[model samples]
Target: MSDQSVTDSRLDELAETFEFFDDWEDRYRYIIDLGKELTPLDDAEKVPEYKVEGCVSQVWLLVAEDAERPGALQFRGDSDAHIVKGLVAVLLTLFNGRTPQEILEFDARGALDRLDLAGHLSPSRSNGLFSMVRRIRALAAARGGQSEPTLH
Candidate 1:
């Protein structure tokens, strides 16, 4: 299977996983658990330049071209807030290790909505989530392609 299919399937799996929880509390705990699974970033990587702007919490994101893949990128990110970190994980699952054109073509907000987070997240948190998405797409654009149409 191709890497692009993996990205799309991962998001589908996440939505399925979320569906197992009947309540927001359980879903929230699951989200936090996902955050715990993120590969921790070094202190140096958390510098100002890597910090995602507009986030209520201190969030850092790094996107690098995958050494083995011609156009695909790998994402690394973290956040001070547990929920935000989980959100970063979700974004990484959706966008990481894919080409700029692939990232540009994915429906990220639709995936977020599928996870049922769109209306549940607080305004600040939701804004922070979009900020992360914007940064990821901006990185993709910088790599030499236009991003997908914005859903918001």
Candidate 2:
């Protein structure tokens, strides 16, 4: 299977899992648990250059080409706030290990909406989430890794 399908399936799984929760509190805890699974970034990698601007919480994202996957990119992110960190973790699970074109093709807002998450977020958190998405896309674009369009 293609890498994008794998990522998409994970998003589907998350959406399904979220459906089991009766309230936002349960979802929040589940998201927080996902964040807890992420390895904390080293203090040195938490520098200002990687810091995501326009977020209420401190967020930093690091993206690198996946050596094993050739053109794919892998992400590492961290946030100071628990819920925000969970959001970062969600983004990572959604976008990591995909090629630049794949990243560009992904509809993050739609995916979040499918998971029934977007409307529940405060304006600031929504802005911050999109900020991280832009950062990831910007990094992908900067790498000059754009792929040629394929004919269906």
Candidate 3:
């Protein structure tokens, strides 16, 4: 299967999982659980350079393109807050291992709506989420091309 399909499938699965919870509280628990599942970034990777701006919590994102395949990206992210870390996991599930075109084309707002997160998140968290997406797209634009640019 293509990388885009795999990412889409994961998103779909998440949507399906959200359907199981009737209340936001249950969903929040699920989100926290997902955060626990994320691979922790190295302490060195959490420096200022990797820090995501505009976040209420201390969040960092590190993106790297696949060595063997061009345009295929991987993401490592973390947050000081549990809920924000979970949010990072959600974004990672949607964008990681996909091409730049795929990341740019995917309807992130629609996905958030499907998960019913749009109304649940605070303004700052929502902005932080978009910031994460923007950072990913910026990385994609740089690495998706023929030239391999250094990821910040």
By lDDT, the best candidate is 1
TM-score of each: 0.91, 0.91, 0.87
Q: Give the root-mean-square deviation of each candidate in angstroms.
A: 1.8, 3.6, 4.1
Q: Candidate 3, after superposition: displacement of residue 32 in Å?
A: 0.7
Off by over 4 Å in 3: 1-3, 67-70, 146-152
Q: Considering TM-score, which of the candidate structures 1 and 3 is the better prediction for this target?
A: 1
Angstrom error of the Cα, residue 10, model 2: value is: 1.3
lDDT of each: 0.86, 0.86, 0.82
Tell me model 1's lDDT, rounded to 2 decimals.
0.86
List runs of model 2 lying over 4 Å from the truth: 145-152
How do all the candidates rank in terms of lDDT, highest first? 1, 2, 3
- Of candidate 2, the 10-residue stretch with the lowest lDDT total is 143-152
Between prediction 2 and prediction 3, the one with superior TM-score is 2
**Candidate 3 local Cα displacement, residue 54, angstroms:** 1.1
lDDT of 1 at 49: 89
**Candidate 2 lDDT, 47-133, residue by residue in tens:** 999999989999999998898889889999999899999999999989888888788778777888898776888999988988888
Backbone atom clashes (below 3 Å) for every candidate = 0, 0, 0
Clashes of 1: 0
Q: In angstroms, give how far residue 129 of model 2 lies from its true place.
A: 0.8
1 or 2: which has the higher lDDT?
Answer: 1
